[model samples]
Target chain A: MRAGEIAGRPVVTLDTAEDIAEVKDVVFSHDHGYLVGFTLNKRGWLSGPMKETLDWSGVRALGPDAVMVASGDALAARDAESGATGDAEDVVGGRVITDSGRELGVVTDLVVEVDEQARVVGYEIGGATVEEGPGGDRRYIPLPETFAVSSSALIVPASVTGFIRDDLSGFGSAVDEFRAQLEQTS
Target chain B: MTRFAEAEHTPVYSKASADEIGRVIRYVVTASEHTVAALQVGGRKSKALLADWAHVVGFGPDAVVIDDEEHLRHPDSDYEQRVTAGELDLRGRRVLTDTGYEIGALVDVEFDESTGELTALETDRTSVNGDGLVAIGPYAVIVRQDAVRPEEEPPAS
Candidate 1:
């Protein structure tokens, strides 16, 4: 699923179609460099109005100013292949397993990049600094096309789970070394 | 050359309270000042603080921010460890709540680039957006920099 960078653009759907709020930010994997779920901000008229954010699962289409979803009906409007979303205030915590079965540290938040045009790049994962350290590690887990929202779990394809467990050492000094170089050059 | 520029004489601004100069001169610098020929420095804030800064008009980039010293150190939380890893700074940090307790790190911060204040943080966990999504602000929540912990198995450093 994707949340294109459009400030107030609204996502639309067919019949029981739900409006996939504008893609506030997109999550991407720093390790593999792939598009993940998007962070959306529900449109509102008043200030301090509640904003909504959903996983990339609901999205079925992506357009310039709008995105179409598979189905975003009522309360159960929740379904994430990423697994478990208690709410924006509370997210399902635990390390994520990649499709390759690698360990991707508990997903912490979403990361986004916007250009001058306000165009958004694909979303990236915001990994927590768990019992991990030193930039921890980054892995891009596969995302299912859709998932059923459980009371606590977002419910994603096992294909993703299979890979969320690789050895964290694979990133060794490689990540750090690269980061050092980027800082030096920039 | 810039004030305190490559010169033989010692700099006075550095010796004086740069913070005070900043606090007193914000009106001219932040509000608008084309050229500052020999303006004095303030010692109100810090020389570390820049004269010109950008503001975020709307949603920009996501960044991790640590506010309230209370949250910095909790009863049974290792938040300090996470802060170091995320390299968090108040200038651009993401704020998050963990099961009612605000926790987590900020891996990335978003800015309007144009306006540039700090729109949000690229959070680590996907929290409930209250409505039906996950995000820190308009920005996603990022892992606390300190939370980037050491490996289960230490390498031969």
Candidate 2:
């Protein structure tokens, strides 16, 4: 699933079935390669931001309808003391370049492997490297088993260029093949 | 049960003197307890006056009766100060669930006349049972997710 789609989904509590808050933004840890947590806002229009944040561990289920939690107590004050910093938007628009010095594209969105443990498995890119048209066509590039990511650029192995897929439907296998190739080369 | 709208603007009287003191204006709520902490009394030519719910003798149909005019005082605590400043009044505030769904705007509140305990929170679209209330913040009133239901749906099991 695209991480952006989860942005506006309501955070519902399983125990009381209350829609306590709405997802304001998805927080992703590029260093850890997984969802970190979410910044929240009050549900109604014009409602102000919430002080507490919902950590990824507190999420019971990331369903199509809502982000489920055990109860309102699942939300906790953001720990500024822990240096917790991750806003998924920081990665979007960053240049996607290979370690071999090939500039592929600019990141458009994150492809999340949705499950009990949802994680970022690939990135959707759109730029001159993907196509030749006026609006460069978008493509999905699998992430290597290990890679370096920063707010400015993502450095993947050159082998990733060959595994880029046109869409997300069969992107899973491409990721698997790309990982296998990297393991074999190492 | 008495709707806040029905209580508002009603004349307030002192049981000890049987003299009219002021009119009930707004309720100062203790959000955490889901109870009315105090009543903002006005309509007299003086500073903003408040009577704690504990001092209220009765919420009569035609008037509100208090123990004495002495119970009325100036807003003191930070919470009461906020309430007196029109920042913490529940009426017209948006109602939201903990999950962040917008239920509706709180139009009125129903409470037990004798105990000052809230009975229900009424919005244009639905009525939430008082027990589901979580917090009444400056931005919105937060309730349990299951507590919000479509006007037509049966209460959740």
Candidate 3:
């Protein structure tokens, strides 16, 4: 569990355990450094939120590799049928964390709503971007648009063709669509 | 937009009030910094003049942040997306990195949805020194010089 070494592992129940899928990842609250849910790799292929979720209190132990959860039949997580946050984030940093090896960046800024809720909407990957420019200045990038590339470059979604559109820019159309999509959801 | 303009964003929030909406005090996080300082359901990041920011940014310091209210969807929907996932290539004006190691992870990113400017990148863990912050490698710093296509999100298992 040095770092970024558990991205593809599966969390399975032991022969003696009846419930508790082997933890695939640990999804933390994007804002606070608290454990949120456990992704049971076995259940991630499910359709929707039907995936099980271990309440924040289900965690039993924290280590470099896996966060030990209370073994039980009801330990299913909301996204167990889906996937979730990893242990690397909990053992070392908080959510919205990216670990390739030992590189760590504490989230200092968050782009949220202009309303009272001000809920987190995106992150400013400045910790590592600071060295990507002249004099090593940090460059802002979005998470949905970013992806780890061999732990070196944090590529944005724009760089990846077919993922979205080429001319799409700004929050106008996408924002409207994003909002519209949410309206159609819950 | 300053150095990290993406982090400093501008979103069109509903002209709604949280005064009696039964609010849930949440946190103000950037694109990558999922685990930020704490949770405060004020109007803006500037907790000092929260009263003023409450009016412009939110309804009050207690409004609820329902996805329907803010139109947030999948995965931290409330969190702002300075950039889109399809546009990671630094073709149109993009900031460049130094080390060119491409081994570190992209903890998070910032975007200005208003003008589509990506300004900040939060790394998982970095060593920011006189030469600037680089990905924390076991022995040295990890640098990213070029853009790489994001691989398909593999199955969790």
Candidate 4:
């Protein structure tokens, strides 16, 4: 499932049949590329700060509207560094610059493989020219050869710039190319 | 695959007679497995049917080709749950880091056109860290917080 759909949906408990909280975030394993659990934000102003994270095992089912859990007990606090979620990083809006300091665009989205293993594989870059209008272009870049990130900026080598594609179908082609290159190197 | 954003409203045609059956609606995937189980078609508000993946023949650029109308069936409980929870669309969601920094909103999603499998997410925010993806969920698209740098803009003089 795309992460956008369930982000703010209500969380319900099965036993008591109560609407407990709204899903604030979806946590997953970066390495395994699978959903791990969900973090809960309190319902109202009076609820106070509650640390409730429901692991994947705790989920009974994901329906069209609300997420069903076995019990309120399923909502418990989890260590940020634990398997409850992979290393959480915010990349969208981070600046992209080549090793030689040529600025690209801001990261607007990511293309994740959502089969059995849901891992992030690529990114969409919206450069200044693309963001100037409604019909502006978006460039798709495959996961690069070497890149680095800081809280503010995303850095990649110049060689990776050549792999950018402007459309979703092109992204598929780029993935194929990258996979083939990997096989050749190995 | 096309972005569900782009795939939405895409017409579905029957291979038997090449008749326009319905337009694309949304994809239904299980929460645990994250695998697309079916495609909800005929439109979002109308009495739509779940097009089981088994009968899906192709995800063409212009239209989705299906075996026949017989493959379209009423959605079951599993499919209903994901829809009620709004797990189908990941576009326009927000992004946050582990350090509690709010990044930006998601704008696009990439998918395998052939299998209708989701491949990636695009956000309004910029990134150069290659594929520094960490996790995604209802709250935010979390990446490696340590690799994040402060926003590049400087204070006005």
DockQ of 3: 0.01
The local lDDT score (0 to 100) that residue A8 gets in candidate 4 is: 65
lDDT (Cα, tens digit) per residue for candidate 1, span B1-157: 1111211122213212221122212111110111211212233433322222211111112211112111211112232222222332222333322111223344333333333323333334422221211222222222222222223211211
In the order shown, the candidates' Cα RMSDs to the true structure are: 20.8, 7.4, 25.0, 19.2
Query: Candidate 2 regions off by >4 Å?
Result: A1-27, A37-90, A95-105, A111-124, A127-147, A150-186, B150-157
For all the predictions, what are the DockQ values?
A: 0.01, 0.04, 0.01, 0.02
lDDT of 3 by residue, B51-134 (tens): 112223322222322223343222232222211221221122212133112223444444332232334444443311112222
The DockQ ranking, best first, is: 2, 4, 1, 3
Task: Please give the CA lDDT of all the candidate structures.
Answer: 0.31, 0.80, 0.31, 0.60
Q: Which candidate has the highest DockQ of all?
A: 2
Cα error, candidate 4, residue B105 (Å): 30
What are the models' TM-scores? 0.22, 0.64, 0.22, 0.41
Better of 2 and 3 by lDDT: 2
Instruction: Kindly report which residue stretches of model 4 are placed more than 4 angstroms away from their true locations once superposed.
Output: A1-5, A13-18, A28-35, A44-49, A57-70, A80-89, A99-101, A127-139, A144-149, A157-176, A182-186, B1-157
Q: Is candidate 1 or candidate 4 better by TM-score?
A: 4
Query: lDDT: which candidate is best?
Result: 2
lDDT of 3: 0.31
